[model samples]
Target: MYISNVTIKNYRGFNNLKIKLSKLTVIIGENDTGKTNFLRALSLPLSNNSLDYNQKRLSVPDINSNCIKIFYKSIIEDEDQEIQLKKIPKVSVTIQFKDVKDFYETEIVHKWLTDADGEPCYEIRYDYKPKNDLDLLLNVKDMLKDCNASEESKWFTLPVEHYEYQIISSNNEKQISFNDLKHVVINTIPAERDDFSDSNSMKANNILTKLLVNTLDDSEKNNINSAYTEFFAAIEKTDTFKKILSSDADFENLKDYINQIECIPNLPNLRNILSNITLGYGDDFLYQKGLGERNLVFIFLLFAFYKSTQKSFNLCCIEEPESHLSINNLKLATDFIYKSVNKSNRLLQTILTTHNPTVINKLKINNVVAFNGTEAISLTDVSQNLLDYLRKRPNFDILKLLFADKVILVEGPSEEMLINTFIQTKVNSLNNVEVISIGHKGYKTFLDIWLRINKNNSAKKIGVVRDFDNQQKAKEDHDVYDAENENIVVRTTKEYTLEDDFVRAGDNCKILSELFGTEIDYDTVAQSMKANKTGGMLKICDAMLSPDKTFDLVLPSHIMEIVEKLK
Candidate 1:
């Protein structure tokens, strides 16, 4: 089953909100930003509210008990306007099952605790008065009557029991859990503290136990070690895994145990003993490994566990995947996650949070989700050209001025020359100013790279510019080009040669190009613009612009004309 959407109201810091979650949703926010609260709400099973706290494991029991109430909504209809039209104040959730078994079991169960007047319990807290409570009681009673009578009323008022499914944990100050209300498994990786042991199996256990599901005999008191041992055996066959865990007596026992279960192949080699084997490092063996290696282990372990469980759809949420990795290693991690999700033709959603711009640049544009405050902004909204410029010029920091801004993206040299001149002379006081060159290459490659970079960072001002070529076409057909338009700003130039028009029309390229002289050819003019002394671009432009014959050689006016146009 896949979770499509979640609507939360008056839950924790979220007063009233709706979010359409992606398969891989990377919830991003600073500390105390309510991201955890959002996770807890989604992780709750539809039947959770009806059960007493002690009846089952709540992924976030403290939250379930402490928060007065919570609301959940999901898009149920594939193409039903009635469902879409039904908006806020009415909450709903829908889950789509891949198998017939799940489809039959899927149901919408709502949980609400309201006063007689229909006001939610928490809402009444702020404006609790004798009159308000009386009115609320009446409203809730009417709502309850409607629920009892309506055919579509699968909704459950609070203090009602349905099913038990959710996991919550309190280790240190950090809390973690998995709720089934929206079919999302939320895992809050615990941060290490001074009192924590070097190899605290907290996070690893929480995740593996759920992933193993039936395979893990949780009814036993010592299933943790056995579960981990099984998970390790599942992936140990691959050579990549063996190098991480050498031969050991305990490993042999775990492998023998796994062989008995038939989930993994038996390995009788002296080296193939333990299931969960890790390289030992100084005093703190667990913390000593490089972050990249650790991240790799984490991702591989996750996939292995999921594969072992045979779950077709998985929503994998990770935080700061790049926390301790180098750029190269980060790239590897990215590839692994992408490949794993897309492999076996199964649907696996991987969502992660990061502040690293380079990582954003490497991802597919649409896959990148950027966050500012609590808002999840879409990067696809930016123009393709602008995205291209930022990708090529990765060092350029444009995050501060991307939104509500005017951005100009151009190809190198000629396009830059023409547009800079035009903007300076034609466009008056551009509100938020930004200019970028995606490179002199074809517009398609430029657009592709740009979108990839900008897609993940929504706060980038993006635009595109392409050459007229010989056809004098702003945007043309190129079989070699891949990016298709609707996102470019095309500009046509009439010239025999690609570089000719701008080179000929300048004081350098700017001045004459600005005039748009009919007879000028930039290539012809550029030849004469070269400076005799310094042999540099600025000098060449200055010499052409100068009135006096400063240079020893006397070049013709047409030759000096292009250089003079440059700014």
Candidate 2:
């Protein structure tokens, strides 16, 4: 079974978010936009206390600040709105598992199944709320009301004092312990884990423990336990312990005061000793390796551990796997991850968050989820041909469009080059504005994404720039999306193309005339620009931005509209 969807409410960095996941999900978002929190959300319902150590007890700081503020606001508003105990906000997370076809998966989720007969799916939910006692809830509300009336506001102290966190199966709303869900294994390797100093040994130990889980099996562990038994006997057979026992006769009178107590090597459990195992690489230990090599080793170890161990379901979540690696190695790492997930058993699934563009190339667009703090937009329904077109060209940094507050998408390289030059030289500094080229007829897909991620958000603007091969169809394209979308401004060229519009825009032809340093007419320049679009546009851009001419460059009206909107 694999995670199909994740819903989070009032968790850290999110008021609410829901994203549909795939087998190999590549989450991309700017810093603090819920990419890291989305990975951490899985730890709530699918954690194994023996494995994951980042699982600290939930506290007030873990609650979303907005939810706390709203709770207080509801308590103070008019004093007549009947605030029920159930209406109090709760910080929660839900993970839904799908495709339970095999016996192993079915047995694990049978108790958690919402529907045992239909296409099988299961949900496990976690909630942090005040206890479900009616009298205690009433007392909690009274405390809040008293605090509100006396003006002694209890900051950062509302949810923790009276709240308890619980895990419940959605099938029958029955509470379950972490041990009950031991069949699910999830290991999250953080980004900053290369430091192996004494102070950072916890991080170092975490990586090693995960590696050991991949390296050792049940039989190997049993063999080690038996070997430890024999090894401890050998140490006890030495003369040191016999000397202490033989001296009992000499201290017979002292023995009456302090019975017979023998000194021996006192060690903890076998697993504790194994946890102290040190790995060496070359001359130094594994943790002592350089950053890039150590990180690559971590990836290899996680991959090995994820596939080696058998479980009902297995998941590996990584944050910024591209940390401290060269571009060439990043590509290899991404390719390795993609192929490993593809070739492994159906039980193995991997989810990772990355800021590096190369990490998404091999993973493809369909498996990527763009998280924007409050919502998630995925490319699951986008055309395969378009997704492949972007994947084949790594030069196209699609994450820029996802991260930008304002964007303008063009048809090809010519429009991209010309528009960027114009924006930089003329429009001053639009720091959050970006220009992306997605070829022709690719606006609908990204626009649909923009509409989803930016819905109910602040007025983040996006412009669509394309050529009008036919002017009548161009107006239809502009009017349809422009009227339907408040965040989008679709601007198509009035003439046949941007080049044709440039030839017709006032005094713009003179710049092109000076580009070749020849007496070329406007119509011929337009025709030649069409024949060689990128090269012709490059020369035009060079003349305009780095000019040796008397007059300034004048942008075409259609192009000016977009530039003006950007400004």
- Using lDDT as the measure, the top candidate is 2
- Candidate 1 lDDT, 229-300, residue by residue in tens: 676677767676665554456666666554444234355321233224443446646445655556555655
Residue range 265-376, candidate 2, lDDT tens digits: 3574555657766666788876666778777776776667667767548888888989998877787788788888888898878898988777876677778888776678
The true-versus-predicted C-alpha distance at residue 235 of model 2, in Å, is 8.9
**Model 1, which residues run further than 4 Å from truth?**
8-41, 44-184, 188-284, 290-293, 302-314, 344-349, 353-406, 413-466, 470-506, 509-523, 527-567
> Please, what is the TM-score per model?
0.44, 0.84
Model 1 gets an lDDT of 0.41
| Residue 544 alpha-carbon offset, candidate 2, angstroms | 2.8
Q: Distance (Å) between predicted and true CA of 402, model 1?
A: 7.9
Off by over 4 Å in 2: 49-51, 78-82, 116-120, 132-155, 196-206, 213-276, 427-430, 440-442, 455-458, 528-532, 547-549
lDDT of 2 at 478: 62
Error of 1 at 244 (Å): 42
